[model samples]
Target: MPYLPARAVATLRLLFATLLLAPLAAQAQAEPDGDNSQSPYFSVHSDDPANDRLPLKSTQVRARVLGVIADVTVTQHYRNEGSRPLEAQYVFPASTRAAVYAMQVRIGERQLNASIREKQQAKQEYEAGKLAGKTSALLEQHRENVFQMNVANILPGDEVAVELHYTELLVPTDGVYRFVFPTVVGPRYNGALATGSGTAEPWIATPYQCTAATTDAVGAAAIDESAPVFDLQVQLATPTPVRELVSPSHAIDIDKGADNQSRVRLAAATTIANDRDFILDYRLAGDRIESGLLLSKGSEENFFLALVAPPKAAPSQLIVPREYLFVVDISGSMHGFPLDTAKVLLQRLLAGLRPSDRFNVMLFSGSSSLLAPDSQPANADNIARALTLLDTEMGSGGTELLPALRQALAVPGDQERARSFVVITDGFVTVERDAFELVRKHLDQANLFAFGIGSSVNRQLIEGLARAGQGEPFVVLDKASAAEQAERFRRMIDAPLLTHVQARFEGLDTYEVEPPALPDLFAQRPLVLFGKWRGEAKGRLLIEGQQAGGAYRVELPIRADQAQAENQALALLWARHRVASLTDQETLEGDFAYSQAILDLGLKYHLLTPYTSFVAVDEVVRTAPGTSPAATPQPLPLPQGVSPLAVSPLTVGAAVPSTPEPSTWAMLLIAALGGLLLHRRGPRGAGGTV
Candidate 1:
């Protein structure tokens, strides 16, 4: 062997050490198997070895639809199987439009109603309660659609139940009313953990748990045997007879009763995993669209909700050349069903394009690539090329959407041609506000439509993108509905029912109307409005807009005396909407006043928000003060239709190395050091070498 110089020898030793440790490090970070279960990413760990994991026991969902509004209640049961006390934390998802109003905590025979407080105040209260050895629970909103529930100081063998209630309005799309209830919060990809505490989002710091199985069967079975089962039921009360009732996501049993009422529940013995959203869709008899006003009276203030239908539009005689830009997400989260759905939707949309129109396709994952530098003519050749590009170049990577969106917006287009930008994705991104701001900034350039594809797509991002883009949001949970969804999208954009719409109140003391300015009406969906009014309820609410032929106007008489006390839900719903609008504005303006307003509104209406939280406590001491309760994270189910491999390191049941054993690097370093020492010692342990 050639004699190596001292510097070279040192360098080689270091390189060898690195090579030995690299794989060891990776394996060490691998997810754990069921035999040695551990928390995945974005989870907090407990100190007590016995209280390592807190398993969710069960989830029950009940929904009641009265007219066009739905009141939903969800109950989650958690059990502490360990010997020591533990603090359980769970991160979950909900509908974007849901107006959460109440939360309750049940411990054995005692039920505690949570009270909403400013976020910081609630956190302080929860910590104090924990320190005082009291049992407590806290509910906080992490994102518009994501929430966190924390239960502190649950004694061993205790089964605690958390109940949450929310209400939302049902806006029919294409004459069909759809209700979505999301069950799982998909694992978020965080490149690195947060450096400091007290960050705005604490759940991001929770550690992640990797499981050993990826397939549906193995994944479902690999979960803790104590994991919770789900039970869901819905009572639908519509004024008109339902022509059909269906649940594409779940096997459901529907019982139709007299008076246009029906009851729906999950089919018997149906093994439902909390991996997919539960969707219920119904069509009314004759497919008629009805619009009306709802009023509610309170001791202090009065509220009103109005839905106005626009006149049907006639077929356009003038053919307008338009430019269409399609943005598709090829992120790892959208590997299987979501990507397939996008492809099917895009094909249908491309086929419907007129020859006079121009289109381009942009696929993005970690980076973006456009089919052409500019928009291409919608001819057979370009369409074929686009399809081929989709086939060859579409692959999964990190979800870097902002850059792709920026590139799409920067693509120069023909000034005279109308522009419509369609975005297809599972919306698995946390930077929703940034995306919305970008769309809002480019509203003058193109009309933005968002298509959310997946069993439990991010509705907040989808709806926000459309609202900012001045268009509509469409969701397709299954591939079978792609064609119908595409057709609906085409019809919605092809004609405008009304434009430049404005609402005016005469002889009414109306104030704080949400969505101060209305966008053009594209479909038969109602124009919904929520506002506060004073004085006698006798006033004329006038809606004005320009139709195909001329100006259009409709007036509805409002009577304050008709306000019913039972409609208190209207007030809470309106407050929630106002808070959402204010939060969006706050995100854009970075104003503290908007933040304060949201906090005040949340406290007033008892709504959980980013600036507010719900907290409940029991007076009795549960755990000792010096002995801290272990912080246990609850694992969420893998979303339906999402492959286990799609999640990689976060796979539900996949066996992954949590930590690597001692690597060869130690041996290499030891050998290298020993060689250097022997070289220094020379022959026979003498100082000098011959």
Candidate 2:
């Protein structure tokens, strides 16, 4: 966090091709655990040496979340080894219901957090009578959409195993069930899609494999591979057309039947090779919200199943009270455009604060300070004072985030009101775990929101912290993103339209479906949900909200396959917000299920996933003399200052290529050795040999 002098900054900028962005890794260190024999630590790495961090080996894990129950089992192996008992710290990417529950941690008899088992027992006993065939009103409240962990204490030479359990509520939704996972971004796993439907149970799973391409003399070459693709089969009660769109792969196949029914298939492709994530966008779209619902008719294990629905009335706005704390980093890194932009945004945020709302600003660097001595009702004088502080000489120093967070949490407010802390930073350090843990400790009262600045900041850290805080993380990719985020922030802070919202569907005994948890209603946006629906006839649909004083409920009429477009749009907006919020919370579900589907579709339709290659591999696999015989594999260019074992983003989702020894350097060294030997002998024999 040290701020380089102005001249130093300029000189460094001139000397390096890129600005002095944040370093991606932290130096390893040992800390004391209560147990002397066991100590555990966690670190992240990337194969991209340019990143300069420990590479995160690609892993496939199993995870699930439901009402009050959260579980994750990592099939991946741990590589840490030592003779003493090591404190294993599992890092959770976001906040979850597990935090409040006793998490059962098992790594071969070293039970770290067994209190989780007790919590589960208590939950089961608490709901023994009404547990079956019932959903809780507070169900969604317990569900965390993002999960990351840190384990402490482990013995040396012992194989590490991981299992976590907690509880959460699944909010019911009216829209299609959608899940997203990021394998990598923008490149390798580019433009992938998958689609299928089933009844009874819903699940999506994908197995990922990694590999590389073969080439010749030049440093560049085309990557090609052929592997077994997973099978994708879904049974439909009626004819339903499935369409997939993937990058590095494109297709258009239209089908029509004599019955006058029509189905359209679409796909696309891209050129960049990167270890990008696969995004799954699925929904049952039709002319209306009702009727067009398709139910699961195949095996009960299909991941997606739709059923008949109803119409939703237009939503009304309600007022929600808020207590906010703004945390700003005024380190030397912010001396340039970063600081200026932050000032403007702060001003906008202050302007949007209401007189009834409570707020404070905590600016940190080498030290932390508040805008005022205590929390103040937003007013002209206080707002002006906060802005004035921003204009003062802000110096750069080492980032001490813990103290700043402690100060922000110390701000007092009504516990019932929605509390929030917004952190703004360029995210340029390695204190990811400590900072996030601090936020986690005080998350019960305030939601943490983050606005990440800079082009090369560690998004994982920024987004991870926000997720842990049950807050939203905004990225300022540039001016455009900054402006857009500012506006979004303004809207979120304006007011809450509703609180503790709920939807109840009456009349329909033969139906089977689950909905997303109802979310906290925000005035800035509407609420939307996606879920499954089934069977005939329904009664009146009811929507309820808890206001500051009284409860509000509205009853709407039902239809078969038709959905109200206006209501659906509002729901879409709500859905987007909920997903973003879950991502920030790191409790959102992973995209593995959807990713598997995309990979399958990519393979069947020749699409590209981190695991699926879009380029034609048929010829490469059929290596014939006529066809370019697997061109003699050439060595990949080694990055300077990087080790041969470094993971390459290009190689993610594929097999690792064998590295060849440096041929030119080896030849030169050998030739030098031979000449030295000859010279030594000649010197010794000289005239005698002649």
Candidate 3:
């Protein structure tokens, strides 16, 4: 309540990163991340560092949006600025729904197309080529959205270009279509034993730039020329005329062409650094959605994608007595802007609850605490108490989400009432799969709704949590959108757009459908189905569901004559979806149960996955064994609004920050708490409401 504006809080905290990060970390005082978890370390410019050593120079992106599908090509350019032979490594991110199917590497006049293979096999190939002094590039998936690229054995003055080609299905929500291009992966909170972080996730140890922090109003006082620049252009062709075009994340120029076509590009001389996700949202000219069937006839397999729009949501006139639990995150990474925005969102959500509803609040950091022992009636007094408790919290410490989730699930609630949980966080932890498994197991107990609060949050974790919990995920990038998103959450909880969805294929030889069963639809988004068809594609696709307290049905005719060349991406998309589903199952079981299946799918579709990788090697040797080479990790710019503490202050040859030591921070907190207790006692004795 008595807090600075969220943006102001974020700006001040970000500007003081160098001075406050160490002391804050000391206060949070987490134990050693036992699972061999890696933390980013500060990079030293004096350690023989040169511009050339930062091999990654820039990234160029080109994308085309055709109706409900998007095809994107990203090229990473690395030029060895150092005089000796060296290898370069960079960690980045992509859309969680991206189906990366192709990769290519260019060395001078020679161009080599990469091949998909088993992950270990690809690693072996890259290592062999590195030892043989051949230039090579390897791409691997660390998380659903996180990826790593390693370009090895770059000789002096040599340049390398690695290109990734991917496609994603664009599903519209509430008539608005959004495309997200993640530039950098945010630092993750590696918990105890790091059991969930996959095998030696070295990408977490990358360097982060911390020197200069600024806001949009202040712009960048000075730009780092050596740092990578971002360039992107998107050609959008919709089925209907465009009613709106905008990008809330960046400055852009839109050139509207004839018949629902437009060209969008970064504003002239306005290219920015790769520090945050790029988002573009647009709406078509009409209230109706552009949803239909798409088909692809490949040499070996025929694919079909069906997009069925659900009916609109029903009115919420009757209130249901619900048991609600609000789980909040107050970790160090959410210290300022994210925390402030979360507060606003919680205020709107709790204040809007009906008096008949029962609710409780849980706040988590390196630990967690509840507002009350049990769920309390949504009265003014209880709501006020919860708000007061949240207002006193200062975001600090590591994100211990799994422990908090387990505790929430154990809380007892009324069996007669529908149980629902609202989890609000930036989703920066590494235990995503474990968390998903936990939610999936107790799904009968409660449906969890996740609100991702940050500029560039971990969408993979948030989306995964919702998917496993059989609920919905919402992202609020700023405080201004808090009320809007909160209202949407309330609306969704009132009723789903469609339920009990069943798809029937008549006369169509469909096999290997991505999801054997369909889940209820909560928004205005279309119901999507991907599968392969044998022989002719002649059939009727019938979908039946319940909508707005009434029976709803949709029927569409499918024909082989409708197959298009552009729809070839459907084959890759289907394979990717299958791999994703299998990966989730494997994670839920805490083992590699479906690794082989996923690997086979990746290889067959020429896509990338956790069990598979893309590797390109130039046969010509470029260096000799006698030459001493170095391995330099490309340093990334800290995500917008993220402080420096997101990474560790410890690194080879890096200067440790001068701040209160760990012991001093603990001692200081004890004294402050004691004094605060005494001060509150005095206020009560003076007949004041403390």
Candidate 4:
């Protein structure tokens, strides 16, 4: 027998323990796979279909557009079909820029308007009211673009309608205006399971429904059979004639009305699947851009929004060499339509590049790799090679976007040339703030454009990336628009509409502008400014910027006599913009002061936010506390065009699986072999030692 060293024995013990416990750990963390026979964690019984169905009954969206601002109303109907009185919670999505100000709950003939409260106080009040068997509702903000609504004490066969109202500014890019209504919240991949009891965000712990069939196929069938019904209508009024009205996401019928007004509604027999986003795009007739000011007076304060369109720059012939880096996501969430769309978009973008431009393609999943170590000229051969690389390397993996972005940003290019980075992805990862910070840090080095590709892309991530990188965000919902989006991108990158922008306010007291500093304007987008004003509004708003060869300026007169105090929405919209600005500053500075400011703004304005929530309660008790039904987690529809494989059973939070380095494995093997060698060599003999 041979003797082994102490370190060898310890290493062997650890190796055996790891090998034995890995399987158990995996089983404990295993996600639901829509299989009842194989899963031992939860039992699935053959029960009533009514009990298994989601409590959501119907959803209706109505919109009214006046000039560049839109007022939207969303109403959701919920019914308790089961025997027990249940508390229903539904997680939903909204536009990142939407300023939600009002919410109401309708029960039969009675309607209750929800009030804003601090998040903790609101939760306490709602919980107390629920335990008392009273009917109540609470709306909380989970993320900038995601919200959760909780309706409590809904008796069997009873129905409740929840209506939310919001306002948003519509800013067009390249003469095209788009309005999107998101229907679903995609499953998030959390790296770790939540522990401890907290009602701060109960929806985050909602269970995901998985099925043996593919998400697309099963989702479509489920939507056709049991999906909640939606009736969407929009009344659009433009200052100019509505030249073109199109719904690329759904089939909609548009009817022209009097005075540049039009009515739009979904076509007949079209099912509103919660999986995809509904988008409406329209172009105003003629090339003229409208620039004006909107004034709204509140009882306590006055707010104003100014819009200024820059003059188009004449075509220049300097033709400076440009470097473009394209970073594409091959993550599992982007396995199907998203990846295909990216391929087509990348091809179109590459084809649009000139021979003098330098380009590189980087594909990222669990790791990132470039088509070339250095950027190559956009020649035919290089473009062909890049296409081949994309085709061969396309596959599903984890989303490691931060590392890929770092890799792309690290690649040095000619300082004289304008460097641009284009990120194409479904934007499913949770590390959005990290990516934003990284881009902001390197923004001076390169401009980054984000192309969000999917039926329901993550708007917050895509928009935040662009804002941090001082670029524009483009959303491509379908394949038909890929070429058009690519062309838009080329035109935007060719030359900026306005650079070195500076705004001067003459004879008007203005403070706390939403965006303290203005970035260069790209494409045909108008310059929008929101701020608070005191004293008389009689002042000249002057906007000056640099164009191709010289400077340009525009001025607009503001008058206080035209201010209307009835428009209280302006105050809420201003608060929303201020909150957004503070959030961005929080990301950049990582300071508690910014968070405090945002919280104060949300509370004062009654806006739903991470720190503030809306809660309402009925004074009379409806049901006994002991007989209350359990809270049921609502299931979300899978985003359209996403495959089941992209959302594997264990994809909660879509956390990237940790992989050990090959060197570590090699070192472990070497240590084990050394231990065996030591054992074979045997212990030192007493006689040899003497």
Candidate 5:
């Protein structure tokens, strides 16, 4: 200190003071109103006024269920209410495994069907159509579950309707079937986004509806008239009586039609905003999941799907000690309601741990922190201490997930105990592909289970993590459902229903089975297999497994006469599952080995894939001779129960950043210290001042 002159000392003190107050100043500016904080706090207004900015009016969904297969069609109506010609772009979600095979657009009375084309080719065609003053609609897949729709040239007072058709096979678990219709695409946090990075996801640039000024008791934003109205109806048909049919997400009215048929629709009195996921669950009479074969004989190809029921979980007397690492998200998105729900879930999860298990908790946001240096015993004292520490986190900052994941995997552990990583979050980050690859590379170390803790979580990331790690995905739509979901997860982890599974083809000639090797049946989900059959379907399929320390076998006979045209979805379903497998393989072996194969599959099947898209163009010009349509990205509603903190409107075109946030004043101090150290250590010129 004595070596420094009075001038240098004063300069250092002034610099330190500025550094200490910088974040405090920023905090004041960010939350000036205390309710809404827009990052990069500026709004971009279109040339048109707010009244005409939104062209999308309504969306209608209809689903028909044939036993376990569901065919769904979603129709979106875009109306040009204002005087200007408009182009509307909407980003939405779908089931991760949905096979979108068709899309069509209707204008007045003329209807034009969309054609599946290579992604670049489709984009070119859509752009050409738009440039030619023609009406066009383009559908593209940005992620497995996320999609974007672009409709061009809607003249004044003209209403154009676009319908997308897809099919998904509903696999039941624990004799309970679930059908999920994702309604909104939550804002994504892109860690790689930077100026000149060029790799930023364009979809994240879209706008989201803001209603933080008023929040309901459940912390859901109030729906304004600008939101599109949604209507959903499901025709459920089963081979046996459907019992306990219910929807945990929406209030519905059910009408029993036939002996095994039911019509379900959203109650007219209920709110119709598409702000959260629509989920339906049901069980067959006697809670029995049928084990059978579905045969689809196409003119060119023959496909078959098999489902073999696994035995119920047997209570185990011998318990094995295990290691559990719980990864939790405490980001700004979890600031209010979401954070509360996560706390409740973690409480239940920690309390339910077995006394023999060793457990630890890792809370992550911009950075990660561990409850302890190493795994702690699941004792009352440790549990209380851990919970107390977790309770202090109020949830702030960006969601930097990969660093936390790497840290969790790097921890040294005992190889003898079975290990599992449980992650709980809203799954809102854009680094899902990287996360999946990370989990896939470490499968030898432990399995990963993901719990999405919001009304409209990113199912793609949650399910992908589980899929990559050979575990399962769970969602807690709200706080009320957290306890039930947590209990189910704990039970599933402890009980293995079947093991040592093997499937063999007999007289039936089968080829190219999607999953060549089957995993041990931990939950009550059936062993499902997809393949192509040749010659005839008359054969016996045999499967063997171990249950409760005893050998178990099941054989199902397939008859050639049982082939049905109603099972036409099987061929497309097989292709979708194959694409998924190839995708996983592509991630594992990085050079895109399966790229061409996936492209060929998409082209051959005319299905929507990462490599292909659907585009529809009306030949006739829609806009006037001189006027051009204004392109408007549709604003999506804040997924129900999500806080405004999640969608910070943080970046160029409204995307969130993936950097450490000024969560506390201490962060400012740390930054100041860093600057101070750098200043003192930096090299000086020969004639250094003072």
Candidate 6:
């Protein structure tokens, strides 16, 4: 295998590749015969391209070439490690931009180079001619060149390795060159089923960097340097190699060991420096962030403020004993990760409740149920039983948010406390305006806190409900995030820091600020405010927040010496009041324009809207008002590009062409012809060695 020179072998590899791909171009057109049914087991079929999801009978690949000039010949190997028989079909996407010198397939113990040929079909010729320098033919659908044959049968426990050897023209470029191997799970003829699973891992390696440049020079600010001769190594796990270790920023050396395990070592080599900063990010397994802080020659004091909110307000402060109610959504979609995570968070919140606090739990689906016949104060035995009962409940039925909200509010609970309702859901419904109106009507001293789950949660509805109920809203993106949000809830239940926060600045003209009214601050959630600032610095302002029974007043001395501090103090005051105003809208005396601005901004930026989301690219501009000063211009639509792996179930057949090639007698004819021809010719001698 290692007998030939590299230069002479490169020429021979190009020659054989051309011969194996000519026929596919002549008969590439296939139509769709739609049949949609759920089949438990995978099917294999030939002839119909639409049936390409299935496998075919069997195949064989043979390759060879001698490179006389380079003094090295490429060696190839093939293996079949698959459960069912693999009908291997190799198709080199016809390329006019770059010539493929050689290709190989690995099946069981044999490795052979693929036969290549120039596709003469009119469409293939036209496409090949048009693709002058493009690296990919994703936009062009017709041009193809490659060989695909089937392995009549591969029993359960099988593996295949295909090694191709050829001299590829090393094209020099200034930017980072990325060579991505296709890993889509599709037809073999498409040359897309390139990913592995379970214990095996597929790897790709490239040689050294050629040059170096700064991030700005390349437009990717995060990358400090772009080297010319960059060595890139990538691996995807599969059955043969069960575990593979790789780092995003370095090269990993992989070697097969004697004990059925692969050893991988990642080594970092080059460092790129930039004008702004140079920092190394490393998370050694599960360790927290370890940072190095450089100090100036003289400075020593590290002024830090750790604000720990107290548990429960004092009697003299703004006393708002909340009448707490829980509305839990148990819909069918929440059955999996969503509902399970929600249950754990709710139990934590319940545990934080004090003896005097009144609460009730309402579970909802198509119908709603209460934890107890009536609301009761939190007690050790009752709260514990409530948590246990929630575990036994399962999510099912349609999401009926309207009725659920109504039932939760109407539930006879602790009316004596300042009422507050907590609703947890994946936000799967679209009950818009009506739901908001209902929340507003039923809302009183009780504010609403909404916890949302899943990627498609209706942020608008949940946030809107919270706004109406004068509460807070949080989202759980995945299982990991559930704990954080749960902690926020626990903190809120533990104590109320400040209540009824209001601010009036004398130095500047009135400007926009968020959270008009402040809510009682809990330990977990940080109190942040948003708004525009204006005017010159002047006098000191007053800071007043109710603790337990009485109001605590502090003078925020705004010295001209500390101008920035004064403005920030003013901004913080504005933010705190804005938040309070949002929740306490019913008590406001003016128009709802301030709250409206918050809602408008949320929709514009696709922020955590109470009820909506910019689900698709088009939704980015759909509801945002064009005339508004805050409106962002919609981007122009671009042509769709092909993806590697169809990861999302939603993207399955939509991106690919609807019509699939039919598997029938025609496939058998091509297979028989190719097999007979290949056998008769018997792989033109040894052309190249690995």
Query: Which candidate wins on lDDT?
Result: 5
Q: If both were scored by TM-score, which would come out higher, candidate 1 or candidate 2? A: 1
lDDT of candidate 2 over 1-690, digit per residue (tens): 334446544544453312111111111122112222111111222233222121112233333422112233333233233333222221222222222222333344444332211223323422331222111000111112222222222223445443332222222233322122222111000111121111111000011122243322211223322211111111111123223212211132334444323332333222112122222222333423332222222222211122223223233355566777889977544544556667777777778777877788888865688877767788899889888987763334434566677777877767767788889876544345456767787767877888865433446557668757755666554444466677777654554345576766676333212334554543222233334344543555566786544576766555544432232222222222333343333323334434444333323322112223211001111111222110110111111111111211222222211111233324544565454445445654554431
lDDT string, candidate 6, 119-184, tens digits: 223224223322221110111112111112222122234343333322111111111111212111
Off by over 4 Å in 4: 1-52, 192-223, 626-628, 651-690
TM-score order, best first, reads 3, 5, 1, 4, 2, 6
Model 1 / residue 654 / CA error / Å: 19
Question: Model 5, range 1-690, lDDT digits (tens) per residue?
Answer: 325557656866787556433443443233223212223221222455533667889999999999889999999999988777788989899999899999999999999999999999999999889888899999999999999999999888899999999999999987899999999988766554552111356776556654333567665555565668899999999988987899988889999987699999998643435888999999988998779988888777789999998887777756878899999999877767888899999999998899989999999887889999889999999999878877887676778788889999988776878999999999888778778988989989998999998888999999999988888899998889989988888888885677778999899888999797887777889899999988887879999988776888999998988787646699889999999999888988888798889999999998999999999999998666445577777877777777655655333333335333546635654576566555665676854644
RMSD of 2: 19.3
User: Looking at candidate 4, what is the lDDT of residue 344?
Assistant: 88
- Model 1 Cα lDDT, one tens digit per residue, 1-690: 446667657766677546433543454354333323222342223455686484577899999998889999999998887888888888899988888899999999999999989998999999889888998999889888999988989888898899999998888866789988898876443322231111234454333333443445212323434446888999999998899899888789998899989999988543445677888999999887776888877789889999887687667656789999999987666766677777888889999999999999999876688999999999999999998877653235556678889989999999989999999988866577778888888888989999988777888889999988988888887778899889988876777778889998898888999878888998888888999887777888899998777889999887766677757788887988998898878766654659888888888888887799989988888778756687766866567665432343333232221221123334665677667666655675554431
For every candidate, C-alpha RMSD to the true structure in Å: 10.7, 19.3, 5.9, 11.2, 9.4, 24.8
Global lDDT of model 4: 0.77
Best by TM-score: 3
Descending-lDDT candidate ranking: 5, 3, 1, 4, 2, 6
**lDDT score of model 3?**
0.80
Assess the local accuracy of residue 83 in candidate 2 as a C-alpha lDDT between 0 and 100: 36
lDDT agreement with native, every candidate = 0.77, 0.39, 0.80, 0.77, 0.82, 0.38
Off by over 4 Å in 2: 1-295, 301-323, 330-340, 355-358, 365-367, 376-385, 388-403, 414-419, 426-444, 454-473, 508-517, 523-541, 546-690
Model 3, span 554-578: residue lDDT tens = 8998877788765668998898889
Mark the 10 consecutive residues where model 6 has the least summed lDDT. 631-640
TM values, all candidates: 0.85, 0.40, 0.89, 0.85, 0.88, 0.39
Output the lDDT of residue 196, model 2.
11
